[model samples]
Target: MTDWRSDLELITDAARQAGAVAMQHFRQSPEVWWKNEGRSPVSAADYAANAVLETVLRSARPEYGWLSEETEDTSCRLERETLFVIDPIDGTRAFIAGLDTWCVSVAVVHLGKPVAGVLVAPSLDEEFSASEAGEATRNGVPIRVSRHIAGDHLRLAVAEDLLNRLDPLFVRDVERIKHVPSLAYRLAMIADGRIDGTLVKRNAHDWDLAAADLILERAGGSLVDLAGERLVYNRAKVSHDELCAATNADLPRLLRHLGLGLQG
Candidate 1:
């Protein structure tokens, strides 16, 4: 019988190895390139780390499907019940800029949801992992979300664009805002108590947020679209327009105050 836990362990190790490779090339003044309209950037480190992850993951489980930001989309993944969703070298620009915030992210998606996930940030010396049926952990220690009481100053972490789009009232009341480029690391920060919430808007991709989404949820936090709906994976479209994640229980009121409607 296949040991599902062992498979997760294998992938976790593979993700860390890929993260190490990424850290090696990050901040080395490498070449950067653009894709999909010259707005997004990819560096040599991203490809190098992606190559490592693809090789390690494929060799360990060739039967499993693959979906990665740096790789071409293959519809074959839609047929497999289990697939690897990865964002190797997430935060390429941060990495290139010598920031210690980039990471390698991996998720094992089964039946359209994440069953096991890992986020490795070598430069920051942090690694977060979770299983669908288990608790979230950082460097092997159990982690939980903060229970800050409501009606206090709400912390809202967001992309600069999303911050700019928010109504002035909401923006002024935000206790704090962090301008982090890496989506995965930002959500992980929410899990780590570095931030309280994140509001994401247009052009966010699945690979950018999948692993961290699970990490946040396992830490007693939540990830949802602006409509307060759960985020589903392995969809037909690769990008999302309005997604929000929070570590607070007052998320509904928070969304409403931000001028975004929420659903049940």
Candidate 2:
């Protein structure tokens, strides 16, 4: 098997290049089109960035299967032992609206688990990366999740409706952060300890979570379902249901408040 560190290096470089491509269209009003029956938007920048990623990554690792948000899905990836999962530009709506929270997310999944991942947000001048065997880093510096124990005011990035679902008394001590349009960057915030945790709505896909999931894990955090199951990538069904991400120490408390059983 190939070294995960090397794979991390590959995807980091690809994400940087892809991010650069996306930046060219940032705030320039690149053409946009809707997909998922107009529920989602895809911009010319997305296709351009996807092209760059496909060219660089596939050329370098021809044998690895490919699964990208901008590319048509194929069953071929499920048959491979490893594959590249990508979101050329995560947070397309934010990107179109001239927000800097967007990023290029890429991950290498081996045997259904992420071994290497990278997220490059050119507008924010940030690059987050990790390998299965190494610590997570942002701009070359190691990062860790926030250590929040009982009695500390929890800082969270969650949708309002989801927040409302939690008992009012349970959330009374919580500090809700403004919504971050980019899910990948939102998870990165948790990984780097910018916030305590977040509740992810259902229907998130592999391209959105795979890369950030690895980064969060290496940074002493986890992204898991209510049942406390860590996600598995490169599956035939790429979409995920409601999930939560937080530091290992705080995950159980957050889950308990959500009325989910303790982390498994």
Best by lDDT: 2
- In order, what lDDT does every prediction score? 0.81, 0.92
Span of 10 residues, lowest total lDDT, candidate 2? 255-264
Lowest summed lDDT window (length 10), candidate 1: 255-264
lDDT of 2: 0.92
- Model 1: per-residue Cα lDDT over 187-258, one tens digit each: 888887767787776678889888888888888888887777877778778688777788757577666754
Instruction: Give TM-scores for every candidate, taking all chains together and pairing residue i with residue i.
Output: 0.91, 0.96
